[model samples]
Target: MSSSAEDPNKQPTLYDSSSSTSQPLLSKLNTEEPTIRPDPPDPDPEPTQFLQISYNHGPRPFKDLPFLILFALFVLSTFAFGIFLIFNRNPNHGNVSSYTYDTNSSSCVDDSLNLSLLLSSNNWVLFNNELSSSDFLEYLIWTLVVTLILSVPFCFLVLLLLKHYTKQIVYVSLPFFVLFPIFFDVYWFVACTVSSSCGDSFPLLYRILVLVFVFLIIGVVVWIFVANWHRIELTVNIIGVASYALSRNLGLFVVLPLLALGLVFYYAPIVVFLVFARLNGKIVPKESDGEYSCVWRQDSWVPFYYALGILTMLWSYTAMVEAQAYVISGTIAQWYFSKEDSRPRLSIRSTLRNAFGPSAGTICFSGLLVCAVRLVRAAVDSAAEEVPGFVNFALRCCVNALLASVDFLNKFTINFAAITGEAYCSSARMTYELLKRNLLSAVFVETVSTRLLAGIIFVLSTIYAIAVFAILKGVAKLGVDSYFVAALAWVLLILVLGFFVNVLDNVIDTVYVCYAIDRDRGEVCKAEVHEVYVHLPISRSHRSSIVPRPLGV
Candidate 1:
């Protein structure tokens, strides 16, 4: 037995050994290698490694490069054309020896003054002189200075109010929004009836038509309110969230205004060019005796140049607005993604850099698309006016529908681009897909918020304007047409208020897009916000696993 155990060929079996030898067998089985032979290795040793490319969360490659190049070319061409017009002006090209650059002075006077005053001062050289005088300019400058001084504080106050009292403002404004249209339509109907019955009486059918239209509008307004009742809460929350974001990023106020002011300065020279293009015409005799008018030269490129300047203005304006939206969206997105404990790297300057640097091409591309749509719509509308028929009307409707779709798509595309730093087409594609997935949610957000926010801005702006006018009345000595100056101030105030509201609107949009992204990724960003927004309409198939936590007080 000892010899058998010592032999390597002999196997250790429990049956052959006594109870004491069982331990040795077990130890041998545990310590020794297996009896079964290993299978042969495969022929190839190297394995394939898969790589994935995903949407960038950081600065991406410059997108819409060709559009950027085209934008540059447009600017250059516009300036070149303006220079050509300035240098190559020929008085004899159209007809006469003299040139008159003041083509719009009469129209300007008519537009600037009230109707009664305009009729009274049709030939009032003194009135025209007053308009062009240095003293009047001084007064205008003073009014503007006062308005600017007032507007800044007022805008800041509006921001504060929006941040702290968003729900109150929304609740207060919705009634006004619903009522104003009805009130306006009713008042107009009454005025039209009175005007027709008392003075310059027209057909009774006209009044009937007006009454029917007013009723229809009022009905539509009521229906809209009833339909969107459930969404009001969500809209308010969205605005509240946006207000919170804006309050946190207060520097945006200064940056956006500066950008708008810069755009104004840029367009000043373009206006001069437009004025010069008007001067590139020849003096010609009118049909009336001892009368002359400037007939633009058929051979001259003035018309083309004028159109180009107008196009540039539209494109540039769209680009600036998109850029603002981009900045706000990006800044808000950063705020959304940042962890509560981590030091915030969110800077408006960095966002601005991203917007004007790598993302500029995207902005330009979106702006170009919008501008093209607007131009097409304008052209179609003009043609429709010339040729009034069902066919033309149908065509007009089709064009309008197309333009509206583009405009709507362009808005969210910019929002997505700002957030992801993606190219224009890529951003648009993603945004469309995202919205498609959450169509009802997107519609709910857009429909419920726009009217209410617009109402709030309008009311606040009007109140601010009225106060500004009162201040101007007390301070300024200009006796007559003070309301005109007040109206100017009012327009400026509206623009300021509109801009602030636009920032908030962008914030709302960005939040929605970010929420969509987080849900898709099964990540919870800004858990507090998610708690509020997760109640939005979501399809069963696309329901996310991101569980919202209870909000901390």
Candidate 2:
């Protein structure tokens, strides 16, 4: 009040005697009789001050511990199953008989011989007994031992190459790589099959040439290995590096979709049968020979619609395969020049987002293939039913086989599209050119690896199904019906087998395509793969020229 009265504008001074009291707060606030005050809390509290209870922490969701454990278990299981499949005589509980593991038949004919001679000598079984199996268990043991022994050096070599590849790979084609030929080839195959119509099957020369191509490619590879072991090492290193990247992102790329599709495919056949049965009661189950065989009572719809549905399914499968190629090739290519340790992490949600949209093109491709084949197959079926004989059967088999081969050629288109991100026709053209350039290696790897793997995986999966049957029927004695158990095992086996082999297939194809297209990078040059060659086991050639490098240096 006094200060305000003196001067409104003047600031009140804290220690000015005239304007304000010089308050010595410590002395002013002191009590005369030592008044007691509540003690301030200690800065360092006592350890026992708080109550600590061990409450139940509920089971965790997809977190670190669970994921780690699950991943570990999955890897171990996959490895164990893979080893057994590779080595054992994939026992067949389904037939109380398994693999026709007969070495005596195919052993006499050498795979090294020319295609014509090989075919003349019953080359039908030329590719049979691929792995050594005088005694299945013995072969398995040796493979396992050899695998383990080579693992260390193999890993070291891969690590070195990966270090280089992390900063070397580049894109050659535009960013639209995918589809017109996917379904296009299906149409082409159908047209060809029908044009050549009736009872005349494909020439044995076609088969012979195919077999020769496979044999020559593999033989050349072996020769190159002996001559130039380094090429093999480089090739392996590339595969290893690509495989590692693939495995890291495989959840979104391969496994999830495969299982989902497997479930759909497995159930679709049953649903179709039920629908056909309910509508017409014509689809009847008759036990013929050793097992229950269901036949759709002949009318217009039985074979026509049935075959249509089947063909449509095959096309859908092809599309999915193409889609898989898109994701896999991109992932491998994108990470090709990245540091191995810090390669791009594939987020499942985001990868799905990216792949799902583009996948529609492939789906459309499949639908087209299905439609074309549907028309052609209808004719084929009508003719076959009218004229029942081996000729018709042979025609059906040969045409269908051709269809299958043509369908598989989509892989080439897929590889091109994946790398260049180009449109379908362009990709196919380029893919053709690239494969033409790297013909031997590309064909050999694509066909042989996939075929070998398919057989192994099929055998393995069948064995798995039978094993499950044994467990459920013989040991567990579950109340579930044998057929139900069989169905469950069969479906699960399909999914698992499909997942494992399909991954390898895509990987091999992508790597080969990438290597082939980059062939022109030049003498000093842009061949991203050359960086890998620069590591150890260097090659002078720019192309992955099927030449093997020396074994060691």
Candidate 3:
């Protein structure tokens, strides 16, 4: 905004210089006529004002350190309580060395199991009932089959729909995501109320739960895989080129699969199963011999912290998923834009350290965000269970829906923190403005890329699982159970594919974040989006800041 006296006839035009140079210098002005400044006019006042919070430069209210610490402990306490409740309610209490965990940090609960008897044998007891464990595997298998059936079209349809109606879809999906939880509870309450007796009521409830769980898990999984399809596609297409160019960093190829395996070992079957049991419905606790209580034989502090550590480790993995994605994006961007790069020096070790080390807290914060949401959901779920009414359950669902919205919004804040090295609330204020500015692109890229990559990962994982299973069965001679190999395979694929694909996930995320922050200003020459990609799910544009370069640029 020039303060010089302006001609009354000169209309305040939104100037954009035809000059392509990003770093503009007045000395390089060829002619007197500065056709247009190209500087983006100030952002729309509505969005900035709409997103204004108290968090800003001159803040002097209170410290969040103590609050964060207490919040972390509160989350850990919930998990610890749940674990204690699980153990106390178990029918196989005598079988479990409940006192042993007091001494042993590793084995909190007895995992003594015959994989053979559990997986292959027909005679098996589940939860003190005659139901065979095979049922679970079958259910999982069926769910996978159905997911596969729906995934192909579901993924591609999103691509097309986003192309034509990106804004509408984004707006619709967000609100719909919030409403889904409410619908889930309303239907759940209805189902439970339909049955009066314990025998009929519980089974129906369980069935409905399992089905709903399957729907959600499958939908979520499929969406993620397909959204990130580009990463795998990129890797396959450029395998020779990238491998040759960055041969020194070739270890990433080997390290990725191994890391995937480690992540899989931690992520799959057990964690997923336990989460399902906890969230799906309440497990029937077995009868205690004398008293209906198990005294805390040891300090409860130990187990709770242990659970916290576990949560930290798990969420840290997720956090790195975002960070490493940033790393890859920066690397590729450098590679692509460098005009005279004989060989751009990159110490992979140093890069990894920087990504994970200094940004460790940011990563943890991302995880904490998840844990916080889960803790809130747990509290709501507990209340819903204790007070059997549609009203309570509906409220729970509404809260959950809002939390889901929060989680979506938090990604931008997390990205801002990751790049700019800001605190949570600080990043949040920035995220609010960013979203208001580039809401459509943010929604499209995050939603589409995540799902695309996840879908691709699923397919790749299935193939990898098959290969691994065959090798294990034939060579190792460890034919150790039904769907164990398959399930393990799925988990491994998820981890490996998820980790790498999420790299693309965060890349797309970061690029859009940058776009949002840049706010229709600057030479976004590096982000020369292709017309074809402009229609693709993840890269779809909203006629805003995202300017697509002609293909083959």
Candidate 4:
């Protein structure tokens, strides 16, 4: 057996034994070590620990410390200024003055009345003598210093509040509420101090102070607008809600249904007026005496164009006003009417309280009434010479002024009516009552329906008047006895042209309103459901793969 197994030629071939032994050696070598020298130990990863020095770290804390110190200084300065103002001794010791420190001066009391009546009655000189006698310059400086000091704390507080709340309503409104009163007070002090001391000769310091405060006011306004950018969207939404509510509450009774009626009755008549104006053309040119022929041309259609423009403006105003009124009415109702009751309550007592309190509404109303009266008087006086029939002209002008006043009053009154009506009735009952009573009130109905009508009438009358004057002149040149029929024709043609222009305007306005509604609503939709996608770019460190792969497979 040994002989056979050990036989070199007869035993297993060297090729077969060698292959088996080599396989085991290869397997051991592959298992024990990598062939590529293990990437030279990765260079110990280059010592990644680093010192990050940030300038912002120490500087941030230090920066805030100065602001805090400045703020504290400002508060102390304000306290000092207040004490100075309260206790400053009057230099003129012998003058027993009747000047009462009245903080409760009625702001709503007519300024003109106070100037004309109280100042004259009390024998108070337009310029108080005491103001010039004292250290007025010092007081002015003190005023400015006080303002600056107060503003620092105020600005700091505003910044803190804005940071804490992070709401647009507070951010926008708070600054205005804070700044307006401060600036108003500063202005009051400056004006009173200046008028009392220097009369018309305002000091350079006063002017500088005014300019600085103006700039500050502007900055505050800009900041408010910027901070409350998001609130603009809210405002627009509020406007839309208001408009819809108005349509639902007021339109069904007063405006829309009446508008429908006007469209049915007056619209046709207006269209006819336009058509007549279009058909009867006026003289484009007329010749005068030979040597220098006078070229007489008439813009018979110009009145129509003016009319149309006016109508468009009026309609736009009415729409905006109505929407605003709805908003006011709803807000008032929610705030004053609906609380702690099954039905809405008027709370006349609260209303009276607000009227008497320091609010803008009473001031605005009184101011507006006074201005309107002044305007009417001025208009009447101005038109006295130009009008052919003075009394009739005055009456017409008065009527126009009265109509405008009514429109102004209507804005507030309609809101009042809606509130009061809602208070008296249940929501269901109120809705029905508002629809019924508001519709029947002819003045309200007609006013809402015919916002554009007055414009149309005024344009036609103006055009007719111009055309008649032109024809009278032309006839006088031709010969004063030239037929009246021709002059009448010219006037008719002018009126017709005015009507056409008005109609064209109405059509354009209708189209614009439709487009605006679509655009506004479309914006609302886009804002509501718009999708935004965010993408983060890959950094260099993140680009490396976790596992290594063979270069060429």
Which candidate number has the best TM-score? Answer: 1
Q: What would the per-residue lDDT of candidate 4 be over residues 1-553, giving only the tens digit for each residue?
A: 7543645565543245545354444566588885665555444432211211111101111112332343334334434433443344232221113222223551111112224345564655535555555443333344345434443343333223322432443334434444544665566556656674654467667766876787777676566556755444433233232223222232223332343354356334334443333333222222235222212232355355335533433333333333333333433333322223343333333332322232223222323343445456666667766766967686877777786765544443434323332211122232232223212112322232132222333333334444444654554443332224333443444344333323222222222222222222232211211110001111233224222122122
lDDT of 3 by residue, 1-553 (tens): 6666556776533342433544335434656555775877546444443332221112123223543465456446545554654454434433332323322342244445535544534444344354334554544455456545544444334334434554444434443432444565555557566656633747766866765775776577546545654543432222222222233233454444455566667455335334423332222223367423222232344354446545655564555454554355334333333344253456344335544555445555665676668778888888888898888878987998899888877766666664454566767886665554443344545554455435444544555556555654554433445347556546744654455444445445545554444333322333433211234233233335534222243
Off by over 4 Å in 1: 1-59, 91-125, 128-148, 178-216, 281-299, 435-440, 462-491, 539-553
**What's model 2's TM-score?**
0.40
Name the Cα RMSD for model 1: 9.7
The digit string of per-residue lDDT tens for model 1 on 1-553 reads 7653566666657555635544655666677866776866545421211111123356567777888898888888888888777776654442332344344552111112235444556768777776777554676777778777877787778778777887887788767665666675666667766774533575667767876887787688778878888878877787777788788788788888899999999898888887767667544434346554444444366788888898898999999988999988887777777776763464677788888888989999988887788788878988988999999898888888888878878888898888777788877887765644443257667667777777787767656666756876787766545667767876877777777777787888888888877655556767867877888876444434323223231
- Tell me, by lDDT, which candidate is best: 1
What are the per-model C-alpha RMSD values against the true structure? 9.7, 25.8, 16.6, 34.1
Per-residue lDDT over 455-548 for candidate 2, one digit per residue giving the tens place of the 0 to 100 score: 4444444445555556556644444355355555555555555565576567666655555444422222124454543443222333443332
How well does candidate 2 score on lDDT at residue 236?
44
- What is the full ranking by lDDT, best candidate first? 1, 3, 2, 4
lDDT, candidate 1, equals 0.72
Better of 1 and 2 by lDDT: 1
Provide the global lDDT of candidate 2 against the true structure: 0.46
- Per-residue lDDT of 376 in model 4: 65
Provide TM-scores for the models: 0.72, 0.40, 0.45, 0.21
